[model samples]
Target: MIIDESLPGKEECVGSLKNILDALYVLNGKWKLALILCLVQSSKRFNEIQNEITGISSKILAKELKDLELNDFIKRNVYPTTPVSIIYEATEYALTLKNVIGELSAWGEQHREKVKQSMRKQS
Candidate 1:
């Protein structure tokens, strides 16, 4: 999907391809979509996210959160209270993704079922 100079008068098509790549740049990870779903459930602190998203290393979670924040998909609120505290919540932009994520999850489930049926038939 690399855009090249040969595609003359195709700036519009190139733009569309660029847009899709930008999207995949953010949501192109095993953990990112799941992390978004978890955040959709409720606003949470760093430790809370790490706990709820079992097996996620602190470093990886931090990277994912940073990526989401950069993508304008989540907001990080810092409280200047005791010991300093922060909470991450889905932004309005992120909220818009709820329906999309739901549909994707359903599709994944159905795909899994189909795969299982195929496996069973082969066995």
Candidate 2:
């Protein structure tokens, strides 16, 4: 089959698609980004993170924390103490997502406003 020389090559398209897939594989799901955003703001204990994010169960939070730690996005520090305090903090690597998170936050706000306007118009 002949190919269009003006268009992007198959290899280029595949590479881009692979990159997107890799990103989604790491960052997909409702709670991962939110959890990262929370830790980026401040290191917190498990209960504190759950309280800040709201509605995330203990089980899910534990899993997400482990996932982020494995991905090198967060550092889980365990202090040697009677209660064994553990604080979760965003790592420098996780800071790489700051711009992405900011843009997503802006888009979310704009989308919410747009939907509200559409609903009001319909009413």
Candidate 3:
């Protein structure tokens, strides 16, 4: 890959670096970023996403959608049918997160275990 000089050098890429930090900025938050990634795999109905995410109120979901749309991470399409259906899909930029999402999930899994171990030790 043609590395950009403005970007971090290969030697500085070790440890908890900014490449991942930049990703977390977009994918951070309890339900906001996760919702975007979940929708990215395929177009999903609003209710479907809500049901899977759990504990996300319709209002919050609506707000998250607006934020993601504003950031160009997601796109919302509404059909003018009798019942008016809405679907959310990830944009090209957001679609670049397949590997990122995997890395985060793995990191989170390890972090969760470390926390559990600490709690056990403290107890």
Candidate 4:
């Protein structure tokens, strides 16, 4: 069997690709990153999170929080008060993504400018 010299060995390439895909699968929604960012600043109750993230619905927020919790990206706490309160806080694992988020933000700004330039040329 002939191996493709143009590409890295299958084990190396596939393993890295699989890891990236798995990460994307876990963090795949529009809201997950936003939610993580919000929680990075401080722990917040469910309603507080919902209020901060303008477009997220109650059901979606609930689902996203559960997903984050499952991934160990956030910690959920229960407070026994007159009414029980649930709070979500970003875990240290989530803070590891700070550089990733910062790079994405910088790239996004660059992309926005690129789009604006293209539109200007078209008009």
Of the candidates shown, which would achieve the greatest TM-score relative to the real structure? 2
Tell me how candidate 2 scores on lDDT: 0.93
Tens digits of lDDT, candidate 4, 17-116: 9999998988999899999999999999998999999999999999999999999999999989778888899999999889988988889897998879
Who is ahead in TM-score, 2 or 4?
2
Worst 10 residues of 1 by lDDT: 1-10
Best by lDDT: 2
Runs with alpha carbons beyond 4 Å of true place in candidate 3: 1-25, 116-123
Give lDDT tens digits, candidate 1, residues 1-123.
757656546888898889889778889886888888888899999999999999999999999999999998889999999999999998888888788798887897879988788989999
lDDT, each prediction: 0.88, 0.93, 0.81, 0.92
TM-score of every prediction relative to native: 0.74, 0.82, 0.70, 0.80
The clash tally of candidate 2 reads: 0
Candidate ordering by TM-score (highest first) = 2, 4, 1, 3
RMSD of 3: 6.5
Model 1 TM-score, all chains together: 0.74
Candidate 4 Cα misplacement greater than 4 A, ranges: 1-12, 113-123
**Pairs of residues clashing in candidate 1:** none
Candidate 4 lowest-lDDT run of ten: 1-10
What's model 3's lDDT at 25?
Answer: 76
For candidate 2, which ten residues in a row score worst on lDDT? 1-10
Q: 1 or 2, which is superior by TM-score?
A: 2
Model 2, span 1-123: residue lDDT tens: 657657778999999999989988999888999999999999999999988988899999999999999999999999999989999999999999999899999998979988798989999
